[model samples]
Target: MAKSANPLPPRILRIIQRRRELGLTQEQLARMAGFSLSLMTKIERGAADPRHLAAERLLNLSRVLNLPFLHLVEDELPEEEAETPPLKVPLYPSLKEAQEKKTNVFVPLASPMIPLGATPDHLAFFPFPGPWLVGVGVPFLKQTGYLLVDLRPLYHPQGVMVVRFGEHAALVTAEDLTAPKGYLLSFSKGLPPLWPGDYNPELVGLVRKFLVDL
Candidate 1:
């Protein structure tokens, strides 16, 4: 079959190949690589945020697949940017606290986060090592389901985000995913977003993957 003029980068293709060569399912790879199965799927599909794929987890994936780090990401980088160091993922205070204590990070189900300074309140906590929780961004426990949320502000185009609108929390989609600080399109006119206002939205976190038990 003729390949499309625009093909997935060789880096992504190799990840899929190597995982299959090792006879590992995406979930197995996720557990081994210390990330989420959803993230593994996204990585293979070339849909994850560049920052997520460029962070240390990718390095872990290379190690797992017995491949060099650059083999998976070199094609994604520009010539001048190739030599730049990998981006360091930041841990939210909650995650940092969890990592320090060697326990599952407690995720709040509905507490709205103040992205600038104050911490959001949590209604309850779930103890999953965030298998996908330990990715490029900080993890917030705001949603009920085990959906993985990225705190780094990295996101997909027109992605869903949790934000503090005045005193309450709102799930808002990005007006333009390219700019993290861009305006957020709101769902209703009764809310603070008010039809794409001129101001930047305060971000709580970006939602990506989720897990649920039967």
Candidate 2:
């Protein structure tokens, strides 16, 4: 086998070793990090260097792995012109374009307060003051909280969902497409009627779990 060209930091190597010691799979780690499985695969193989991780993702990896953030810090490696991988960004001129070309697409799922950039084994926490969740009426979450929106359950009935339509975004209880779903974006108002036309909004993901502070 050809010797790997990328020399990863000791800390980065330790992360992989520890995860295996704990018997965690790359997919589990990616879900914990709120990233796609492909991202985790790249990181483990040193195809995606930790030095390239965003600040928030760095913190997330530290928290999830129980490793100190500073201890794992490493300077970026210089990329050889021929060895650099093209950056994948999600952007599309229209919904049709996004569904068609399926390349260089970017989605603004992260918020300023709560960002998503971490080892695929970390949690993507959104810090929005949300009544974005429904069905679970824990009093502790009445004030402020975070939600784990899993993209895998978009079709699950009664599951909460995060949706975007042009400039508007909302969290709502999902109902049959034939029936109207209520928008939970507002905290002070009564259940608002969601027009059926709104059903076609960009389905970001399903609300899998939530955490809140009283």
Model number with the top lDDT: 2
Give the least accurate 10-residue stretch of model 2, judged by summed lDDT: 106-115
Alpha-carbon TM-score of each model against the true structure:
0.33, 0.35
Q: lDDT of each prediction vs. the true structure?
A: 0.48, 0.50
- lDDT digits (tens) for residues 115-173 of candidate 1: 22322321112223332212113233343334344544444455556454344344445
Candidate 2 matches the true fold with a TM-score of 0.35
- In candidate 1, position 17 carries an lDDT of 87
Candidate with top TM-score is: 2
What lDDT would candidate 2 get against the real structure? 0.50
The per-prediction CA RMSD against the true structure, in angstroms, equals 14.3, 14.5
